[model samples]
Target: MMIKDIKNYLKSVVDCPNWYVGRIDGKKDQCIGVYPARSQPKPVPIAIGGVENTTYNKLGVEILIHWGDAPTDAEEKAQAVYNALYGQNPEIGGKRVIKIDLNTSCPVYAGVDENGIYEFVLGAVIYYER
Candidate 1:
């Protein structure tokens, strides 16, 4: 449910047609990977110090924006994502985005994939509550 919530939130907030979860492939205008960080155990819905289920869930997302050939275009798309999501709380697809704390955004990289598409990549922690 959190995965769907996060994917829907990304799509709604970014207004892009290519939002995805878990994997990125094909020729999408945008791609998102919402997964638990490999460095830590997956987050659980149970409250940190209590047995009861909490309304909040938190996880990291790896975001990639592809703009075909131009680095500037990719940067523009990345900026749009940052503006829409960074540090803002928004309700999306019945879930509430409590906060989006950006971790890092890489510079526009050329030939990011075999398709030679220019891309800007970012990582963030998404906090949400239903």
Candidate 2:
């Protein structure tokens, strides 16, 4: 499925919750093409906390998996997403990422990892904005 499809799928899994989507960088402020496209890719760990076991947490906060060497197919990306949110598959690289949507049902932040496996990947989670 494409990024669009993933958005819908995330809604179902995150209890049909809604979340604000955006691209992020590591240990830095959230960005959305604010700079040039060719600008540095944030030098791995585009996310802040650094993907591992800390990015995923709470009912929200998901990471947008990104890939570079080889873009993952729709099925592969979907499965990886499932594992990240549900924490089912401990695949090679599926860890919590930085900046959850805070608006989605599961509030999974959008961003890639150091390896670039989850390129253009999306995160989800339900947010309880105050």
Candidate 3:
């Protein structure tokens, strides 16, 4: 569900038409893939009566941009994704996203794949209400 939410959000923001969730479809050289990285639920404070409550979930998301033989294009696309998502809070799939913080200052350049596709990786922590 979180991956779908992110994929939908990215679809609205990024220009890429090929967006995949969970895994990258190698058929398209110019595409974006979103997958879950590291994630955990955030525990909330206990009430005065000793009842515990949890309202938020922290999800780590990884976005991979692949551009055929175009390292600059891949990096630029990753940067565009970063600019669109970093520090932004928007409701995605009816979930109230509290914030999004990128793990790196910018997208990391991953080496070209065997198919000669240049790839860039972007990681982010998305905090949203459950």
Question: By TM-score, highest first, what's the ranking?
Answer: 3, 1, 2
- Model 1, 4-70: lDDT tens digits are 6666766776766566666666576555545444453267557776755577767676666666566
Best by lDDT: 3
| Candidate ranking (lDDT, best to worst) | 3, 1, 2
Q: Name the lDDT value of residue 49 in candidate 2.
A: 52
Off by over 4 Å in 3: 38-52
Q: Write the per-residue lDDT of candidate 2 for residues 25-109, one digit (tens) a residue.
A: 4322221111112222222322465555322332323344332334344225444445444533222112323323322333233
The better-scoring model by lDDT among 2 and 3 is 3
TM-score of structure candidate 3: 0.86
Candidate 3, residue 76: Cα displacement in angstroms equals 0.8
Give the candidate number with the greatest TM-score.
3
Stretches of candidate 1 off by over 4 Å are 28-36, 40-49, 53-55, 105-111
How do the residues 14-128 of candidate 3 rate in per-residue lDDT, one tens digit apiece?
Answer: 9997899888888788999999885543445554655435566678789899877877878888899999888888888789989887889989998888899999999988887
- For residue 93, what is the lDDT in candidate 2? 19
| Backbone clashes counted, model 1 | 0
